[model samples]
Target: MLELKTPQEIAAMRTTGAFIAELLDDLQARAAVGVNLLDLEYRARALIEDRGAVSCYWDYAPSFGRGPFRNVICLSVNDAVLHGLPHDYTLRDGDLLSMDIAVSIDGWVADSARSLIVGTPRPQDQRLIEATERALEAAIAAALPGGRLGDISAAIGAVADEYGYPVNTDFGGHGLGRTMHEDPHVSNRGRAGRGLVLRPGLTLALEPWFAQGTSKIVYDPDGWTLRSADGSRTAHSEHTIAVTEGAPQVLTRSLTGAGLP
Candidate 1:
């Protein structure tokens, strides 16, 4: 069911959102070459503990997930896109890394993800990451009051299409609140005037993940990490947003802060 958050609930959710954003910023700085994905998970757990927030991913057993997600955060590298289980793998030079995190504070939850290139980035690799960020920005911008869900989806799709990248329709964004996943599955592509109507106090995570070549993806042998079927590089960016009377408010925003590049 789509639960409209009360003003008090939204305020508490903002705290969780800030933590999500701050952790992503910290992870972005720490995801250097030679860092183990497990190390990142450890740091995330500590940070959550410090803030007294509960990780929404850890011990999370969902219908689509394999048993319980054993880590505090998701670490996707290179071809790996979503639901990446952190392991003993060490990040190498020019490796593309995606960190997805979700946490609950005062019973409200917020989720977000970001993709970055470790060490030096190649030209094409940089472009892929940039496209994902642009798509995310477009989607967030479209999440305004009176706007339709399709508007947000179309905005994200337009950016991906402009970059000549195919859309990955299998997994997209969705409503988030008391629980991690909620109502209104938000896809990366859709008609601009259809689907759910945007309203004040409705919070959603708008994510845009794209592969450099094709949209087709396959699950890793681990049954979690999603990777491009063609083994091409991928990028993903997301933000938890609240539809407001003013412009949409970005809850899970990163330190890169203002406008997209």
Candidate 2:
């Protein structure tokens, strides 16, 4: 079912969203050459714990993921895009890394993701990240009340297409509220008028995940991480937003204010 949030609920969700936003800011700053992915997970856990927040990823048993995901955050590097399980791998210079995080405050959940170059970013890599960021912004801009879910989808697709990047819709955004995942699954590409209609209190995550060469993705042997099938570079950006009386409210927004949250 597609869940709608009450004004009070939305306010509560904002806390979860803001906390997640701040945690990501700290984590991204700490991610650098020679840093361990597991260390990122630890930092996320500490942040959540210090704030008395609960991690939605851990203890989450979605069909596509393994039971009780061991890590508090996703640490995807290079070809890896989503559901990146933290491992013993250490980030190196020029490594394109994506960190995905979700948390619940007083039972309200918010999710977000970001991609960055570990060190000495390459031009092509920077371009990919920038494109994904712009695409995410466009999608969020289309998420206002009275718009359809497809409007968001089309906006994101247009940006990706303009850059000649392939969209990976298999793991796009979705409705989020008391739980992390909800109804009315939001794809990365769709017709402008298709799918559910946006309305006041309708909260959803608008994420644009793309690959330089192909749209297809494959799960790693761990049954959690998702990677590009063509071994090409990949990027993903996302924000959890709410369709309000006028414009949409981005809950999981970045500190930079460039994303809808």
Candidate 3:
């Protein structure tokens, strides 16, 4: 069931969103070449603890996930896309990395993700990251009150198509509030005027992820990481948004002034 947020609830979510945005910014700064993936997880844990925030991924055990996520954040490198389990791998130059994190602050939840190239970046890798970010922006613009959910999905898909990337509906966005995931699954592709109606107080985590070569993906042996079946690079971008009376509000905009790459 979709639960709308009250004014007070939205206020609390704004705080949670700010924390998540700052956390992602800090993580992106530390995710340089030669940094181990496990180190990134540790950094996230420390930051969450310092802020007295609870990690939504630490013990998350969804139907599709392995036992418990057991990590504070997700670290996907190169071919890996979603649900990436951080391990002992060190980031390398020109490597495309995606980081996803969700946290609860004072009982409110906010989730966001960003993809960046560690050290030097290849031209195509930069383009992939830009494409995902552009798709996310388009989705946010379409998330206005009275608009249908499909409008958001179609906006994202249109941007992806313009970049010559195939849409993957296996995993996408969702409603977010007191929990990390909730009602109203937001797909990356859909009809322009279909699906649920958008209204005020409808908060959603809008995400757009794409693989460079193909839309198909395979699960890693770890039971969590999802990699491209064709060994192509992937990029993901996300933000927690609120449908308002006019333009939708992006709750998770980075506090560092460094927008998505």
Per-model TM against the reference? 0.95, 0.95, 0.96
Candidate 2 residue spans exceeding 4 A from truth: 254-261
Off by over 4 Å in 1: 254-261
List of clashing residue pairs for candidate 1: none
lDDT (CA) per prediction: 0.88, 0.87, 0.91
lDDT of 2: 0.87
Q: How close is candidate 1 to the true structure, as a TM-score?
A: 0.95
Instruction: Report how far off residue 119 is in candidate 1 (Å).
Output: 0.5
| TM-score of model 2 vs. true structure | 0.95
Error of 1 at 184 (Å): 0.8
Best by lDDT: 3
Which model scores highest in TM-score? Answer: 3
Candidates by lDDT, descending order: 3, 1, 2
